[model samples]
Target chain A: MDQTSSSFVGFAGLASKNKEATKMKAKRRKKISGADLAFRICNGIFMVLFVIITLYPVLNTLAVSLNDGTDALRGGIYLFPRVFTWKNYETVLSKDNLITGAFITVARTVIGTLLALVMNAILAFIVSRKNFIFAKPVSLFWVITMYVNGGLIPTFLLFKSLGLTNSFAVYVIPGMVSAFNMLVIRTYMRGIPDSLEESAQLDGAGYTTIFLKIISPLCKPVYATVALFVAVGQWNSWFDAMLYNRMASQYTTLQYELMKLLSSVSNQSSSAEAMKNAGEGSVTPTSVRAAATIITMLPIICIYPFLQRYFVTGLTLGGVKE
Target chain B: MKTKAINMVDLKRQKVLIFWAAAITIYGIIFNYLPLAGWLMAFQNYKPVTGLLHSQFVGLAKFKLLFSDVSFLRVIRNTLAMGVINLAVTFFMAILFAILLNEMASKGGKKVVQTISYLPHFLSWIIVTGILHDALSGTGIINTLLLHFGAVTQPINFFAHEKYFWPIVAFANVWKETGWNAIIYLAAITSIDPSLYEAAAIDGAGRWAKIKHVTLPGIKPTIMILLLMNVGNVLNAGFEIQYLLGNGLVQNVSQTIDIYVLKWGISQGDYSIGTAAGIFKSVVAIVLIVICNHLAKKHGEERLF
Candidate 1:
């Protein structure tokens, strides 16, 4: 658990050490040998190529989405739009299902992330208490849920029986308390000093007061990390939308709509029908699909910078179990 | 008297904790443990009309049916093949990418590259698959590049071919997850004592030598733990990607156990067989995880439990 502190120091120290190493090796540059230089050059080139390969498809999709739908089918559109127009976007945005889907996606992301954060944090706080009698059993109870569970059919049947199907609750309730998330938050909470809680308790503060006042504030970083995880998961999740709410168009999600659009474009006959249904002969399935794809991914891409900042901490905290 | 007083105070303090625990415990049983009761459906000829209690008992029949079915067997094969391939390739590439990124001289350049690389990861599978379809389509960049490079006489329909399906899925996974997966390994690498690298450098070890001796061994524990964790998930080859990308042409290779369960359980309405398949998968997952944990313990490495 303390590896995080040492790792940060290591990273900070390495950057300066690298500068010193380069300076010390400057005179030995001639003796460095062509092999090492070649490796460095190749590695640099490889990183560049890797970045390009990673970004090309995304940028290409953007180009296709922006290009005239009919012109995009001509097919050499790579980096930039050939015949630029927002018609494809307009068409995708204009779809009634997509609009409703976007609303559902946003609502679920907001409500689910907030609820899961509070619930998981509360559980983490309880288990994190040093003197709590039920802490061990409670932790074990949730931890066991991580390893074994009912499979999809059983889970689906359970949800169906509970009348969660075709409802918005299906999106948030079943996933309310992720065992992995609880573990991550618990791990972070355990790192907090016990004296803080002890001092708070001596001040006549109750467990809930200490948790809400002292523990929660100190745990902001972990909360941010877990919030990003839950938000991204909620936004990106389509399987639930497809599984439980497929017949309920009112509860459709953005990802599900994109999935539908994707499948329509993938299948030949439906793609032709989709092409005609666009009502404008200029808008093809390819462009519409690309536009919808871009739209679906827009929120994630927008928040990715923020996600990147917290994810490493979250991942490492969850990853290294002792 | 003092001990009893302390016990009473402890019990009083436990009141709030007990309420919280009770709430979560109830939610846990309902959501996590309760669904497991539905496993009984696997042993019966389940019918929606009659329900689980009244359904006729049929012992081991659905499991037998699954084993005897060729498609079920093929689905298992596909699931294992894709899962193993994805696991191997993504694991190797993440390690390799972390090492490569570590070797870069420019810190800013490394950060930029890493950021761009993982951009695909946050996108939903639907979007990733959509990008895959667009990129691998006949008129797409892959075929265009192949045509331009004289690799093929004409454009190739990548999705329609069976031989290409597994590789395509593997590649998509690698592209989507390599950077994200590397984050853990990168953290591991960062934690490697700087003294080790200094010692290696003093020994006149080259870049490759340092990577081999210091970096690889430094991250060995992390790698082992992650590998063990993934072993339990080998059956989760993935449902969304396979289901989304699969078509009539490539259905045989593309269908995993999940899709098989979905087809049988939901679409086809064979609840008994679907439950049987689900049970088999869950059993295998738990068994694999327990075995891996045991092996890790014996080997004196990190055990997941």
Candidate 2:
């Protein structure tokens, strides 16, 4: 098996070496050729298009958010702010839940990712052991889940029975171990030659010690991959928050916060007669919408470039495997 | 006496197996695989107040009521149509990308294209739909491009129109997922003995011939297994995007089994009805997977089971 893996390993190693050597070898030479120029232009176009696609709403909403509320509704805003004003941001910031909701979202994502990694890693490592006689059945048990489900109603009822409906534990516990993620980690772990572990055992390390010092250290790439998946999952999790966390006052994840704020305003606009009867100020909801969107996305947008290297590493590793 | 002692040692070695059974069985019972019993609710006039025992058992009544309901059928139709369209488009795009990307000469360029493309897979549908709502609006970029090319004088109402909803949803889904999906096929393609490609090339084969004969054949099993696996998710027409992006104008076309469950089960307190719908969906999904797996086995391809 190692021999089979060696050829690809050698090829990748050589390619990396060539890349470094080329930088030294052609220190004075320009990197561009005719084809390279065309490719660079193509890549530049693609990169611009990709970024715009990614931040289309961010740019639009920024414009709308910066525009005066009346101007926003009059459809004067386009790619840029028209009659720029920060009143929308001011209003949304001063509102009841935005700041607190942001904190709640951050806490959930951080804490949930940590808990998920610990539990998922332990379970995955135990299952990944070649000597574990029950690994096959255990793996099959988890795999069976990818095919069928208990359905939403029963799962909700189960959560209710477990008293997870109103608590913070509900956010993380039910989803701590995703079978697909476990399988990914396990497969990657399997690729680690058993002999490396056998040699470690010869050095007198027990299962737990070997797992902690040897396996865990060696599984850094897989750990990073798992961490990324878990973090992303936790960051965007609102369906659970919406489903179980009623009393909209309790815990509002950012996604849930945006949905609540946006949907409520939309719903309110439909019942404008009711709003008029209530004598609330006529706030241009579109301004608030843009401001709220910006608030919800700003953290992710800020974090994307920082996490992007890890994202690429994790993705390439996963992609190279089945 | 030594044989008996050796047998005892083997029994101790199997201790972890027992632990695995104990742990996973509990997990299977608690979180997954166990919600299956919720199918009972589908037959009962379930009331949370009454609990499970006291609910009136009415066989096929929920199914009958669901069948009779016009909205349910419409939701099913929309679900199937969108599901099929998405599968078709995503599969096509994924295959095209896998082939095109493999043909690229610059390894650095291939990596860059892939990395940029896979970024959307990390985004929540809330964000993706937010982007779409802006991009598909009356004066959005899509409309701007259309008008720039003299395609239309007026901006098209994309999100509101039912006719446009499926295509928009398909396009967004394909954009988000095709890159990620293509990677598996690409990996399979890469693993094909390069000697085969060499052999094909030596026989006066062009790029297309090598791709057709060598690359496609190399990944066919992966394709089949993935096909079998994906058929199981035919009813999952992506709830978040459809739910969040959909307005009253397109609600009739946007509601799926998952969305229906959310509405009737969670929102309206019709838990039994929702469970029935969910159970029905799961059953169909499982059946399709089994059928596909069986077909794959018959054709001498890899089968999941």
Candidate 3:
């Protein structure tokens, strides 16, 4: 079975240089024929339509999130808000649960990404080391995890036995050493010039020093790529939160909170009434839910442009190298 | 004697590396390997109080119950139905999107569209489902547009019906994943020799002709390989979307094996039966993967080991 889809991209660039060359060769400019011109015009229009179809939901959600809750229910909210208001956002943020959930989510993303990167990088380096005595066995041990597992129940039971279930540690521990990530990091590390490390070794540098100073710096692109993948994954993930910390509301992540909020949308009116009574603002559950959805996605959307280059490079490498 | 002394120094140097390796190895064993032993619970009437050891041995009873249970059978059907729908829709949409995106004359258009498209893939399913709920609601844009255009006199309560569940799920999946999935195919297309197009152009082949002849053929291997690999995932009908979107009205159609496992194993405390369902899913998945891998190798296509 596949590991997390994002992690696959991290280590997928081992042989991308050859593929990259092919792509370069394919980039020669050419002229278009009349028929080709006609086809492209139609195709371009079709693609624009496709883009609108794809983007409309997000835009509509934004519209709904911005619209006054009562006005939103009257219908005809399209690209823009009918009765614009920030009350939806105010209601969503004003909820105490959102704050705690956001804290858990932020904490997990930072700590989980750091732990996974550092530990997986170390393991990848160790296994990629040609002269390491345990390299083959260690690689095999991790590789097997990519293909098989003992299923969810046993894994849950294992965590339960270890007293990890419902604890903050459960979020951080199981994800600490991803086999797929290790492979990706190892592949990138393998591409670095061994001479860089060998010369350092001869200069009386230890393995730790060589890894930290030489290989890690050279593999920054892959590291950044993998780090983004891990961070996005950690932020988007709710299953582990639901599974491990189901009993504890304080430990639930924001995604899980949003999931609960969305699920309970069936009883929106009652919740809306409760919120109306609890606060001065009059916000409908539907608008508040949309606001919560926007809040949940805002972090990724904000960082996406800055990190977009990494995603493109990472995905291209993942696709071509595979 | 000097070589022996050098070997000892090398061994000392590797002690730290070995120590780190040991630490990760221990983690792997506990997290991954230890679960294999828990499969024994499937063969026993496992009570959490008694645990695996003191539980009564009941060979194949849970499996028997699973086979006999009508609900489990329905869950299997729902799983297969949704899985096939997901695979078929997502597979085609991704390929078609990639092909069309590749055909665009403007590189900027392609890049911008691709960027905007895969952004949804990054959003958690929670948010996606929330958006879906709003969009598919009676007063939402979809129904509102339909009514405005006189397509229908009344709004279609989409979620209130069970028949729309699989298709809605599949559409949501395609919407979220098409761009991300297309990236692989686009990469394959990029790596296709441009000279093929140059040759076709010299032969008076049109853009469509070039696409049919050169581009499609170029990515055929990728399509075949990915399709074959996805055969193993027939059981993963997706838990999050189904669980979140599904309600009491749609329970019969929405319950997949994972949901079944959660319902029985954790929620209701029928651990043995849940474990049995889990074990069953694993065995079937392993078999499907091996068979698919073997078939890919037999056909001389790219095979994932």
Candidate 4:
């Protein structure tokens, strides 16, 4: 990525050959010399300050999630753990904290992302084909969707009609194809130079073979981009879980499980009725929510940077065809 | 080739398209477009059992209620306020991070920062809020830090404070997406021709000037396109973050239209009003997109259409 090595390469390149020319300019720069120095110093300070202010709360939260709840409440922890104990984690990991709920979350995320990719891939490829007569209408359909959506109640009722109101499919099926992902993909596939298909045809390859062996492999950036979106969408999603999963025993994703736990904790400190229900069987509201959220975030966070590299290419030069 | 061309792709052989399109359109029809019928409920005194047509039409009564209601007014204000803050913070932080990463000069450093920053984007709001809850609680890490630094005598109870709520929301947004958002800018930066930088440097232009002129102008189209596209999402200030981070203490400031629809429409079973709110959001989104597109066209920027 540093095409010819370190910053030193660029810096030295900027310095020596251009020294006298830089010095002549430096005299002019020296006119506001102190001010320029002040400006640069200010820019440096502000940048660091911004990063800290932006990152501190999140880091603090991470520290809290790792801290003992009782000690965390007592204000004993700051910057680092005062009482470094895995008790909160142990409390969370125990099945008493609704381990089945965690399983349901993992299942939903895996199943939902996979289904979304499959649905989007199939449609995108079809839409990508040059002579596909229905492509215009299909693409228009996706475009209009980006602007307007029917509200939640109708969507809920729509899911209910399909008997998805309480089931895991409610979360997975309705959201299978995002318009953004579809369009980006269609834009990408359109780039495959129709001659590739012609050449494939000359070699006697069928459309299916062309798509599988050629198009899919060629569109790696879009594939990675779409996969990341689906994964993130499924991972961070608990609202649907809350909306559909009205029962405590129902399959709750990690997000919903954490929500159920946190809300219960707040409800406990806030309401006696809620407190009575707190830390009860199949739900250790306090520690489990923390654990579930951390656990659910693990895969996405882990995969993010690698995916981000491809994501950059996907956004930048990736859409050259469309 | 002649034999295959003569045989052609008959409908029978087009089973792949048929099966796949059928599978997805079945999804689209049921989940996406079919919900349009629910908009009719906004005009009806809707009952689930009686269904759409049979439900008595109540005209613009719900919309009237929405206009006159103080809560509705508050909802709009809250939505706009948070939405603007979220947009500004996310936009700037993303650009800022992209600039910083550009300066880092080491691939490993860029990769590490990119990884740390993007991790949050994947976590559930449930997890993020949980983390914030413990961090910002009365006796939490934030208070402890401030107390240690003597910034204040005690923890400010961040989640409950109305003033802190929006800032927290904005910061949370920046945390989750600033890096992810920067990827677009970084991409745009990479597209900036190296020759332009060389020319600028030949004239002895410093790093800052090069960025202001060369890099910034180069990315202006990308920025403008993204801005127009994002105009449609202004009303979508996000639901999960505000819902989870905000409590009664900050409810006035935190309750956006989406949450209002959730409370009055869904939670309480008022489908008509919920649909009305939904219709309101859809209308605003459409209007924003149209206006932004029109404005982009007028300015001769790349039009989304």
Candidate 5:
């Protein structure tokens, strides 16, 4: 098993070396032929077009969301707003439900991520320890869940029986330990020199102390990556909110509220009622929905660039390093 | 006697580790294994009032009903068709994107394009679908552009067209995931030997030949492993996009097995049928995985397990 696992690590090592070599070779290239020039031009053109395709939708939404809703309906607003207004954003921000939903989203992200990280880290430490008696079985117990699950309804039923439905605990408890992430963290922890832990153990440190003092600090990269995954997952998760807190309006997350709002607004706009309600504010369903998209997406977009550096490392290590 | 004392201390130390393991064990049992136990609801004629204990054991009846139901059959067809479209388009595009991106000369340009492209992956499905909805609406930019280009006589409500839903979903998926997925393939491409490309160039091969002979072959293993793993996810036709974008008009095309389960099992209170449908999906998933793993082993490729 160790041999097989090490072989997988060999794949990543070779891949990273090749990446470095490719980058170096790109820098050392001497000349460009006509065909190569053409390919480069075409590739550049394709990438520009790809960028536009990926970016235009986002920019269009921003433009529309910033524009006056009534003006936006006249159409042809592609990249920039003709008549800029803050009313759409104002309406979205002013909504009591949305404000509360934002609070819920933030709270869930922080608390749920912390809980999951601590528990999973503790579990990962134990399973990665070579001397632990139940290490193999514990690892197998969690890993098996990755392939087989009792389906959504059974899980829902279990949550219901546990009185976890329609409560905030539903968000944090059911996701307390992720087998996949535990394995990733465990893999990372195993790479830490055994001498580090042994030295700590000689100082009268227990597993818990070594885990907190010796292991956790050294495993920062994996922790940050796992935390990002957990945070984003909790923040963006609306299905759980839809299922578990359908009746508990107070517990609604931002994404779930936005989802509900979008559907309801669309449903109403098609009817005569929404048109009648249009005079109450400058916010149309279209603009509000656009604004909601930006509002929901802004935090992720803001944080993603700084965190983007971690993604390749995290994905490579977590995915291929085993 | 001294060795025995040392052994006793080691056991005591191991006990401290066991204490931590015990907590996780209980959590695994409750969250993971307990759900497996809940699979019994599929076999029972389940009702909330009777609960699992008292529910009548009507084995396979719910599954029988599922196959007999026309809508459920349509749902299955829709799921498989969309899954295939999604798998094909995303798989091809990611590889193509990786190869194209790899061929680029400038590091700064590649980095900028990659960062911009991966933005959509982090956004929630709701946001992605919202962007899609705005882009594909009747008066949306796509129809507007199509009209300007004389492709269509009038605006097309993309979501309303049942036949277009699968392709629309596929395009949305490609738009969202292609860049992120390309990262792995790009890594695989990078791992390919530069000397192979040099050898191809020495043989008087042009850029295309070099790509065909070296780059593609280099990334073949990565593609195969990814493709095999994706085959196991054929039933995950997606829930968020379908649930969000779908209306009554496109129900036939948009309703996946998950939607069916949610509708029948929870909303409609036919727990047994819902659980049966869920079981069917899981069984298909497990079987696909096993088959793919076997095939990968035979071919000497990486098996996920």
Candidate 6:
């Protein structure tokens, strides 16, 4: 008798669920309010405008980069190349400083991201250990670094004193550990179950062994996120090169080379000289700057879509604790 | 004796952890904490030749000079104006874009729009500024449109003018950040309970009414927390864009606190004055953050700390 009565209730629940689903379907079909319709139309139009506005500048830059240098100076190019030429790119890619800069930028990005990830992850792992005695103090020690800093001059002075100036190590060493990234990694590590470590320890695995063989492997997503952040930062950073490595042409990064080009173009007088020197008159400063801009951003654009999924998750994970 | 034995065992167990911690701690001391000693330069008439040790102490004279300087005052004004404008414009646009995106019916289309929107955030400032320069050039699309529409007989040199600097900076910020900032709000919106929306629908509330009552309140905490965090960073109006886009024509308007520091501290080799300006900026930041966090706690909102 109990079973029969439960079955009857379950049937009633299912019927109500079906009724609700149908109601939702009907509601979705019956959207006829003029105000609502107007909002939808307006919203649609706004989204299209937003997309165009966001894209048009980049697209226009690409167009300028592809167009004939002299023709582009007349400045009617908008979306597509009016007079197509590869000379701009050929000119930009052929420059000695730019080539050196690209090599340095790529090397720094790769090396910096790897080193930073490992250091931050290890620090995070140590703090995240539930039984670690100095966890709270160590965490606080790093977190304080986020708020207070030595400021620009002192940092510069310190680097200069340390002989980090005019060296490749200047880029990789000073930024090896970010407090924010460490915290994000710590937050992720904490969510990991302690049982995994406990079980590993029971099998006579040491802390280092557990960290390497167990914890780090499980942290692929957050690592991807942090790596992307660091790589992008390393790639985009030019101020350090401008500041510390200004005299070290060998250590110059791509962004700095682009910056030099951009300033020259903006200055107008030097731009005419720059144009004439570039590609023997086929590449104007405008075209060359656009091409350089495109080249500098191309790697980021190519990798962005692929890494988009990781960043969204990473951001949310970091956001949760912070 | 028993307690000592237990302590030994605990220490033995923690030996590896302590080793790693000590390594990182040393690094932190050198890279992070050691920089604080440089703050003393603010109190000195520092010269690189004499160094920090032998530099003569000047007891707030540099701060006094900073406060009294006309250019410094102008720099402060520019910083505050640009900071406030950027904060308000970017904050509003992000929220508005998020809400509109949330209201869209087609999930696939929304995703595509969002993907496109975030394309600019990945591009470096060098690239963004380059694009801005081209678009704002006299012969660029903006002037071309303006001239074609008979808005002006002559092309307006956007970068040459002082009046357009702040708006252009703010617009550049909005263009670069709006889509990226919207991600957090969009997350907050998605996490809102669907039952609440259903209940509103059942109560015969229209779309706008449902959004007003349900969606806005749901994301209020996120909005407040982010706002507080941003307010603390008010002084960092951005050095790169201003420094990049700025020229001799708009130096008075374009110069910010960071640029002022760079000029006095780095360029002019007045390390003391630069450090003083840096300290001022840092102090304001800390104070603002503390106040905002306190306010958030008092108002029963999420506190960053």
For model 5 chain A, give the 10-residue run with minimal summed lDDT.
Answer: A1-10
| Candidate 1 lDDT, B1-305, residue by residue in tens | 22423376887987998899899999999999998888999999999899988999999888999999999999989998999999999999999999999888866567667777778889889899999988898788899989999999988888888999999999999999999999999999999999999999999998889999999999999999999999999996678789988999999999999999999999998888998998888888889999999999999998887
Q: Which digits, one per residue and each the tens of the lDDT, describe model 3 over residues B190-301?
A: 8899999999989988878898999999999989878876778888656888988888888999889999999998889888899899888878887988898888889898
Model 4, runs deviating above 4 Å: A1-67, A268-288, A317-322, B1-15, B105-107, B148-150
Query: Which candidate, 5 or 6, would have the higher DockQ against the true structure?
Result: 6
| TM-score-better candidate, 3 vs 4 | 3
Q: What is the lDDT of residue A159 in candidate 2?
A: 88
Best DockQ goes to which candidate? 1
- Number of residue pairs clashing in candidate 3, backbone atoms closer than 3 angstroms, sequence gap of 3 or more or interchain: 1
Ordered list by TM-score, greatest first? 1, 6, 5, 3, 4, 2
What DockQ does each listed candidate score? 0.58, 0.37, 0.49, 0.41, 0.49, 0.50
**What TM-score against the true fold does each predicted structure earn?**
0.94, 0.82, 0.91, 0.87, 0.92, 0.93
Model 6 chain B: which ten-residue window has the lowest total lDDT?
A: B1-10
Model 6: CA > 4 A from native: A1-28, A269-279, B1-6
Candidate 6: deviation at residue A316, Å?
A: 2.0
Docking class for model 6 is: medium
List candidate 1 stretches off by more than 4 Å.
A1-31, A269-277, B1-6
lDDT for B95 in candidate 4 is: 85
Q: Residue B114 error for model 4, in Å?
A: 2.7
Q: lDDT tens string, model 2, B181-288?
A: 777777778789999998997897866688889999898887887777677788865588788878889898888888988899988999888988898788888888
Lowest lDDT 10-residue stretch of candidate 5 chain B:
B1-10
Candidate 4, residue B6: CA error in Å? 13
Candidate 4 TM-score versus the reference: 0.87
For candidate 4, give the DockQ: 0.41
Model 5: residues >4 Å from true position, as ranges? Answer: A1-31, A268-273, B1-7, B203-205
- Displacement of the residue A37 alpha carbon in candidate 3, Å: 3.1
Model 3: residue B22 alpha-carbon error in angstroms: 0.5
Interface RMSD of each: 4.1, 6.7, 7.4, 5.3, 7.1, 8.7
Candidate 4: what is its chain A TM-score?
0.80
